[model samples]
Target: MTLRVYLFVFKSRGYIHIVNIFNQMSSDGVTKYKYEYIIVGAGTAGQTIAAGLPSKDVLILEAGGYTTSLLDIPILTPILQKSDFDWSYETVPQPNSCLGLRQQRSRWPMGKGYGGSQILNNMIWNVGHHEDYRGWFSPEEDYNYERDILPYFRESEAEHQPTILKHRTKLAEAFMNATKEYGYDDSFKVPHLTQRNGKRWNMAHENHENNLSHHLVLNAFVMHLLFDRTSINRVTGLVYEKNGFEFEILATKGVILSAGAIGTPLILLSSGIGPKKELINTTVTFRKDLPVGHNLQDHVTTGLDLILLNDTLGMRPWEVFTLNSFYQYFVNGDGPLTMNGCEVVGFLNSTNKSKNWDLGFMVLPIGASADAGIHFKQILNIKDNTWSQYFDPLTSQQSVSILPILLHPKSRGQITLKDDVILIDPKYLTHEDDVDLIVTGIRIIEQLIEMPSMRRLGAELNPKPFPGCENYEFASNAYWKCYVRHLTLTAFHPVGTCKMGSSDDQSSVVNREFQVIGIENLFVVDASVMPNLPSGNPNAAVAMLAKKFLSVLLQSHREKPTNYDI
Candidate 1:
């Protein structure tokens, strides 16, 4: 076999010829590189875009490394949190919420490695409600749920369709029955999981291991984009760190930032491309004065307090370590380990009308007390005093938790750069309307526990008064609001920090084509570009958005070949 080595000089338009790597020498004996396209953050969106584009000309830079087989198990999701695979970020203290959590700060865990959050997230597959797409674009824009969005969702799933649970627990079935008995008609159903053959699956896992390995660079943490010295409004390439050495690489066509809601903004802010005031006194020069980290929103859930003492309908926490469970999982790919604890999901309207779902219910087969306050309490950062006074006495109890989640919270928070550290404050439950919705959800849960389907299984709300809110009368709105304040936690679906909107819309960072409004060759394709949070888990929607962006990008190239030529 003969080795063929070729080199090309990059131009303002595009490359002269295609080569795997372009090398340039400087006085320091350092090598430089360039690519047709450079995508930052090899997470869900980054992998999706890479899979669609020509892999040979594209390059992916991931801050973290690859994942192992042990972390791929669906049941091992919670253990992945705070681990090496997780970014393990935390929010600044909130005065209105997280009163019962340690230090009053909410723990924010974003994935760090190859698959990004998909490597650690509970692999639930949901496309979100159709109404969530309304008004996202202008009337003239050729984008809508049926015309553009739905087809992309279908196209993204064409290769790897979402898998249904083969072996569901008793508690999941009971929650389904309870929804029916509570007067909702056939609206609630089992969630589709992002799994194949009872194991976790995502595009990042498939493409990286099989096809895109040549294009990916793991353990490469992107520092900031390198702006063209002549034109500050344009980005030519980016600088990244790997093995404690900084490397600069150029992109001829464009650079995409799929660095997630938190990572993307942190990158832009570090590069001095944020609000005018935020970039002042920073080390880097300001390029674009836009709202880089404002309009932060997330899905916060209440009703962790809604516990059911169901002796006949709960999964034993220790059963996962049993021989039979392991045998069944390894042999037939069916067992308790296949389930991600969240076996049942339901959508409901707080007004009791059959219009749209504003509240979502996720039923776990076990409660916080199931593990005797070991995993759940630690993962959620529940206060020590709250755990001892409230949940410790009921240790190892067979119980179920029906968590009520707010789909569209009016309350908004922000992510800001303070002293070089990313300060995240979701401002959960800052709006009184958000509080009323949780109370409404709690009342629905009250009605649900009384249903014949739940009652037959000995389902009853745990009567323990929450540690911080004992002064108010039990079951009163005042008590429930206080409970909402203390027990509310993020559903892990944060969006809108870099919102997408029309050019006139001041809150928007990117336009309809996923390009940043004020900059050229800079695009954002992640949950951060969402104008509003999707009505459910955002992973599927993120996948769909990636698919749609691929089409839009390809179309833009076809319309203007010279601009995108490689």
Candidate 2:
């Protein structure tokens, strides 16, 4: 059955500002300043949860406004980054990686608009292997993957049928064949994406007639949680700023933090619910101190390192802008515009173990150098010297790139606040093991290029040695390691900040049920709650989490009906 997916429809009476809500009074003459549940951050999880519950009893407070139609195109995902729709966050300069980027800081573009990071993502619907989620819970836990997780994934797939790329480039086809040649029998295939008829299909798109339409409040920046007056430990509601006006709204039953990994931890720290050492300097009154922002993890890749120059069969940047292509896109929803940057996905086992898909190769049909330092070079934050010296000669060339993403990195980092500034530090490749794995991945790609499928396309590697690694012998282990250090980039899959674990786990901020460890009536359900980074894109997994949590929420409401009273 195709699931009923709701869109964010902005109607005249649908949205209510904090000032307007103040005017709404109860029949008893008291101001109606309450809801049964208040969900912070109307991103992926917020939208999913709000749509599942009774709309009248729920409210979604999103900091950013709604998105535009122009942003709905699948191929336009690249341009959306660093734009107004993006939060445009940058990490603290990494000592070991991101050496090729400008300022030595990796750019982290999170979605600021309605759909959240879904707006900025490649629309890749990768749920990852079952073992990834199965390991999230302790062995003694009652969580079953078939009963709990798989249903949501199936439901999501039914709702948004993955768009097929009928005009996939020859290079993309060869990538799959190469994967099979490399002994990954299960890895040769096109990636499933959250798109329909070549356009992006997110929760914010077009089905707003549902109950969730009226409950959403755009531009409502949640400042802090409003604790219950009688018991300071339990949260009742929150104070949010909208149009420079701060207003308080109460949630009688629960206040859920659906903000992404970075936003969730930042909010917790500001509300004095994180490590006391980090909160000591802040003005927020100390509440329940937990390790909120520790254990930060993200999937880092050797950015566009395996450059494939296929002269006969690849798409160039200029070729995508023709009038015919635009007409085909708008009229038929089938054209060059339908190309999601990473058209094909292949997995490899770095440890040479069967069924352990540790390294993922996200095959991009167009190389960053194919644009000649115009569009992709700037978007990826490649350094001026690197672009001019290495990629300028390959302007508008027919090329492909198979980026090696470290599925699970041993390296860890933390997010902390210094004087209210959100300090993001995802220390990419700090561990020696992560470097070794990436080097192994590069070796696999090198082998894939030599396969008959790739060789038939006249595929050749870009021999330009990276700017800082010119001294080392080309393609040596030492040179590739240096290349990885210089060109490392994030896949933008940040998670595990507010880790969910058993009560005995000291590092846990949330319990197995997603409730804050020490705080009642407060829950966190987003990427922040993930204990480990999944093997692939996390959007689908997060949606499944919301669905799983929705069942838990409904059961709670049924068991204790009076708790939901506003």
The model with the greatest lDDT is 1
Clashing pairs in 1: none
Query: In order, how many clashes per candidate?
Result: 0, 1
Report the C-alpha displacement of residue 543, candidate 1, in angstroms: 0.6
Query: TM-score of model 1 relative to the true fold?
Result: 0.92
Clashes of 1: 0
Give the winner by TM-score.
Answer: 1
| Predicted candidate 2 versus true structure: per-residue lDDT over 175-255, tens digit per residue | 788778767788646888777778877766633534344366776677888887777788888888777778889998888
Alpha-carbon TM-score of each model against the true structure: 0.92, 0.91
